[model samples]
Target chain A: MSDFQFDKIALIGIGLIGSSIARAIKLHGLAREISISTRSPLTLARAEELELGTFYTESAAECVKDADLVIVSVPVGASGAVAEQIAPALKQGAILTDVGSTKASVISQMQPFVPEGVHFIPGHPVAGTEHSGPDAGFADLFEGRWCILTPVEDTDAEAVRKLRSFWESLGSRVDEMDAEHHDKVLAIVSHLPHIIAYNIVGTAEDLETVTESEVIKYSASGFRDFTRLAASDPVMWRDVCLHNKDAILEMLARFSEDLAYLQRAIRWGEGDKLFDLFTRTRAVRRSIIEAGQDIAEADFGRHIRHEK
Target chain B: MSDFQFDKIALIGIGLIGSSIARAIKLHGLAREISISTRSPLTLARAEELELGTFYTESAAECVKDADLVIVSVPVGASGAVAEQIAPALKQGAILTDVGSTKASVISQMQPFVPEGVHFIPGHPVAGTEHSGPDAGFADLFEGRWCILTPVEDTDAEAVRKLRSFWESLGSRVDEMDAEHHDKVLAIVSHLPHIIAYNIVGTAEDLETVTESEVIKYSASGFRDFTRLAASDPVMWRDVCLHNKDAILEMLARFSEDLAYLQRAIRWGEGDKLFDLFTRTRAVRRSIIEAGQDIAEADFGRHIRHEK
Candidate 1:
């Protein structure tokens, strides 16, 4: 209790990210009190059943009234509305932040409604699974993960440091970047991948030649990887795509042009071109593993050890 | 060993798949003697250093001369050349099989060169990582995975059963399907995914708007999964794209069409369509997990438990 940083932390959307933060806060004793709020009563009841927070409220305003820190974890598109709803109730000195994937858009949406004296920092913890909702969260979800904060100019240094330390307490290595740059980088890395995965899986679903059952039976190849990403929360991804349209379309155009080149190379039997690109991509995977971002082996070593 | 199935097993082309088979054979004591052969001297020396076999040979002809079982594990394009080299040396009535991804291409290439008394059963172990070479081989690579056999009608029944038992010994579930069907199923499941992955990685590589370093930094969002798939063996995958051109092209066309629909949906803000497809793809992931084809979490939960 002596190590706890915040007297109370209010989670405004008790879904995966919000519940995960709640769990981590509870596990690490980061907050003395945790308050939860969401739009739906069913979800709030479920969160209460799980005891994800010390207090449950139907009103976002009520949830944040006395909280020292308020985290808005909702779809990126809904940030403006959430911000407006909670703006009047936010404590004057409260450190306000968000866990949205698209930072620039979220900043735009949330900045207009942020109350004076509240530190409004937008963030994205680049960690999640295909699952969503309160039931899908775990305490260690942020362990060894990266959480990016997009703090605007003129933002209070003390407020930013407090939020950084809070996330650091949850086992996350924090990085700060401009909101626009964050959106652009995420477009290439996260947004485009989700869009392409959704597109490919949708393609397979609509295929007349390849049966759905057959696709399921043989997905161990490459398709399953796309499926895992595509399986991400639908509303969340749709909002991300809609909100980050410019960055996404730019990345998409680049991706399509490169794909056309590859298609032609394969069509023309230009094996050298194909070989070079394939060889180069391997180094990137090695770098990722070396960076501790991902494991090198596909079997993930766990199943291998279990079998042994 | 009393439980050893074969007195000797000859492996041609000791690359990733070939070397993995050698390791599994040794670890399980499935073969009393393992003879390894590959065309490249450097790879052969490396295999020897790794102690992958009981005997090492520069000539495929000499390697299979006295072996009870011969497994040709090489790129699909090289199947014919290796088959021709080993044809005259194959022991009479030896069980000859291959672990090739494209069954039709392997069968077409090797069928003519297989001696009359030798049983040439085409097989594909639907398990692998992006990494290659003899050094990538692991003893438990095939554990709890799938092995698909495409046996001709005239194939010897005893040889098929024996090969099935051998794969089972390595902890792989064995199933049988026709050669052409295997190609189509693989085209959608495995081949298209690799092609898409390779194409997307290439797309990201060529982007002028987004730097390569940026793509690499933010890959965990989703681009990284494609990198893993794209990083797979180039020669092996290039051959797959070439050999299964018709099916691959068909799947690609279907994929592009579906992508266009998704792009249009996004452009028009069609949330329902986007949500529907995303939800459906999530179900496919669940099926894959239930089928025991993949870890329910990321790559068998390696990243999740790595720190522990």
Candidate 2:
């Protein structure tokens, strides 16, 4: 706690990501004072009850006043509105960042409102469980997870360094990239997977041949895996799909194309092709486990943490 | 143990499913003698090491001699060959059943080889983890799970009743359904999910734009959930796809149609549509949790049991 960096950090939209960052900051004593704001009075009162911050307000502008760092953790679609609300009260020379999943949209939504003195850096911590809301947060949610910071060109190097240090103090590994590249990378890795999960689960629900109860009953065989992801925050995912449309659609197209080919192989009794694909995909799981991105400690750690 | 039924039980494939049944049967004293056979000498030796049965034989025919009950647990594609190999040695009036995922194909493949006196019933235990091999077997694997029995016309009722008792002893709820219906139900529930998982994981691997390491590093977002199912037994899943082609194709066709609709919604920025679909799917997960099919008890139980 001796190296506590920021005098104050303002968290706008204290939901899952905001609350998680609050937990991490408090656990590491990264900030002397934490101010929180949300659009809903109910959520604001809830945050106060949880004591997630030194001060709670419904005004984003009030929350950002005199803060050394301002983190906007709203849905991507609300980025512009949050920026507009906070721009008036942002401290000169303060680091203003966001933890939205889609970076390009966040930059576009936020960069225009940035005053000359404030560093407008867009970031996304590539970490979270399917659960949402303040109670879903935990101190170590970002531990060993990648926090991608997408700083636009000509952004202050000092501001980037401070932001990196802030994330590092919260147990995240920070890396920098352009906003567009980050969106494209995330489109395939995160957005597409969620979309696919939602789609498949939707498909199963719409099935007339097989009842939904049967799908639920035998889901442990395979379909249940998708249910966990499909149960993600709907509003957040909706915003992500709309904001990262181009990159997500591109990935979705490729995914659909590959799926069609696999479907044909199954229809044509091409056992060899199916075997090859199934065998090849097994290696990716091994790689994920080896990378320490997955909980190599056990097979079901991901789900267990979600339950907790 | 006085209620034990079978005089002699022969297991023709001592892998995960077979070995599990062997342990359950032995623990419950379900049979006077248990004979295990495997084509692979290594597996036979390992099964012997596990003390899975009272006697072990390299020949399926030699193992089934004088057996009143025969349970074949093999890859669906190998069902015909195994049936032909052991058909002559099957004792008169024996109840011959299988634990194949695909019932229609197994019944089609094995029925002709089964002698007139044998009660050839096709059964599927709707339970198993992704893990495979004899070493992965556990006695309680079948607890509180469903097992569907698809009996052919003129199949002996007494034999069906006896098989139900056997599965009940192993702690599975047994149900009767026709072979085609079983295939369709399983296609939507199990097969299609595995196919989609394998396909999406394969698509991720083939992307040059997003490195495999990046996908794995950030997989916790949702992609890692798919990887577990994708890492399942390739040979077993391949046999399933090959054996149950029509039903899987039907499910795949429905799946693609629904995906295209969702893709269009995403392309057209239909947030309400996406939100509605996402919300509807969450109920299925709730139903699953309510049904006790996936309540995270297994992992915690395993943790406690292993600690002890």
lDDT by candidate, in order shown: 0.84, 0.86
Tens digit of per-residue lDDT, candidate 1, span B80-136: 999999999999989999988888888889999988889989999987877789988
Q: For all candidates, state DockQ relative to the true structure.
A: 0.57, 0.54
- How good is chain A of candidate 1, measured by TM-score? 0.97
For model 2, how does the per-residue alpha-carbon lDDT over A1-308 read when each residue is reduced to its tens digit?
Answer: 44669999999988888999998899888889999999899988988888899999989999999999999998899999989888988999999999999998888888899998999988999888766788777777787788999999898999999999999888778888888888888988888888888888988888887777778777767787787778788899999999999999899899989988988888888889999999999899889877876644333532233231
Give the number of colliding residue pairs in candidate 1.
0
**What 10-residue stretch in candidate 2 chain B is worst by lDDT?**
B299-308
Instruction: Find the candidate with the highest TM-score and give its number.
Output: 2
Output DockQ, candidate 2.
0.54
Superposition error at B183 for model 1 (Å)? 1.0
| Candidate 2 residue spans exceeding 4 A from truth | A296-308, B1-3, B296-308
